[model samples]
Target: MLIRSIRLAGFRNYTEAEIHPSDGVTVFTGNNAQGKTNILEAVYLCCTGRSHRTTHDKELIKNDHDFARVTVEADRADGMHDVEILLSRISRRRIKVAGNTVSKSGEMLGHITGVLFSPEDLRMVKDGPAERRRFVDMELSQLRPAYYYALQRYNRALKQRGALLRELINAPAASDTLDMWDAELAQSGQAIMTMRRDFIAKLSEQAGKTHEFVANGAEKMEVEYVPSVRAEESGEELRTRLEKELHRARQTDIRRQITSVGPHRDDVKILLNGLDARSFGSQGQVRTCALSMKLSELEIMKKESGEAPVLMLDDVMSELDPGRRRLLIRMLSGVQTLVTCTDIEDLAGADAGKIIRVHQATLQEA
Candidate 1:
């Protein structure tokens, strides 16, 4: 898949702009605060039906504007698709796919899938489990719509169960509701854990190879899905496991007013040469492992989707080392990529199809 073009209105600093990108790599170069990254943000909003930078819809709208709009024209193996996201300050965001309005953002999946590597991604290794979980959830949500809905159900059940647990501290009559929420959480959490297990197994394989290549075979990397509770593959068995674990943690949940067990508490462990990268690996090792995992998604997503997903590197070139940058350039073989940087020299040897300069939120071809 490729992003043929993107149009933005009242988005960030860009009052109005559009660009048709080349099939291969497209580089956006400019100084800081020039709206280079805003362009990539627009393309990514189409891919995932949300922004990577912020959660507030109003933040995307420019000053004195009540709404912001982003439209993406993408090419896939099947056909071309147009996705539009309209953000309003007073209401929820709306999405349209192929000229048809979609009630849920999850419905916009598969039309335009992408993998993004921002400067913040470098902290994936050392940051808390929340960031790692977001990475897994976003990717899986795009590839498997079923997983997306299941995750939604799981999150709702989790919230309800937590509320019930907190209420039990003062009013114990609501204890019966805990049983119902546990069943719901287990049913959905089981599905999430099963899919996450298989995904991590595949990811570990690809990341191992990529890490070897990126690290010059000096370090071995392994990615593991560490669920809060032991998980089983069979439906009945896994459901039972989740329910039992939830029951076991009910007292702790009530005391803390938090649902402490399930996929929500799970983590992705990155091991470098047999040591946990988060706790033991050096900074270089942590960054390399993170790089391997991100780059490995290119092949994994294609394998799952049957086509390459567009790549967006938002000012990550400046954060990555020369070797990692070179590895990234070599990996952009047939995939369409949008890279933003302050200077072109960051990607000195990259074969860019379009080199555009950004100034005052406008684009100019160089």
Candidate 2:
């Protein structure tokens, strides 16, 4: 898939702007806080119907503005398509694809696939379990609509279960109240767990090869899905196990006023050369692993969707060393990429397909 062009209105610092990017590599050069990242964020929002930077849509709109708009013109294998997003402060955002209104946001996934790498992504390795879980969830959501649906159901059930747990603590209730949500939570959570395990297994295989290449075959990397309940089990087995676990943890959950056992408590463990990356890997190793995981996403998305996802590098080159930068540039072959940098000279000698300058929320071809 290729992003032909994008237009933004009242998004972040930009009042109005349009950019026509090349199909190969487009570079956005600007100083700090000059609306460079905002361009990439807009494209990402158009693709996934969610922002990678923030969950609140209100923050995407400009100050004192009622709404923000982003329109993306993309070319897929089938044909060209348009995706538009409207964000309002007072109401829910609206999403449209090919001029057709979409009531469910989940229906918009995979319309325009993309893989984004930024400085903040390093947290996938060093941060807590929630960050790693989000990494898997976001990528899987884009590739598999069923996964998105199951995830949505699981989250909703988990929330309702937790609320009931809190209520039970305040006023004692019959076990039937908890039993109803347990069955619902386990049914959806089982599907989520099964899909996540399969995805992690495949992701590990891909990321392992990427890590070996990026690390010059000096380190072997592996990704492990750590479920709070069970592993290597069928959906039925998982549901049975979750049912029992939830039953056993009932007293504890009621005391804590939270659902303590489910996919929400799952995690992804990254290991480098047989050691935990989060605990033992150096800064360079951690960054390389993170990059490998992201590049693997590009490959996985292509394999699943039969179209290579657009790659967006949000000023991550500035955070990498010369060797890592070369490794990254080498992997960009045959893929459309969008990169942001502070100075044009910083990307000197790199295969910058098309270079544009962003100044004060305005864009100019260079």
Candidate 1 lDDT for residue 95: 93
Give me the runs in candidate 2 sitting further than 4 Å from their true place. none
Across 129-179, the per-residue lDDT of candidate 2 in tens digits comes to 999999988998888888889888888878888888878887876669789
lDDT of 1 by residue, 3-46 (tens): 88899999898889999998999999988999988888888788
TM-score of 1: 0.97
For candidate 2, the per-residue lDDT at 58 reads 88
Clashing pairs in 1: none
Give Cα-based local distance difference scores for all models.
0.87, 0.88
Worst 10 residues of 1 by lDDT: 282-291
Q: Candidate 2 — which pairs collide?
A: none
Instruction: State residue 16's C-alpha deviation in candidate 2, in Å.
Output: 1.0
- Model 1 alpha-carbon drift over 4 Å, by segment: none
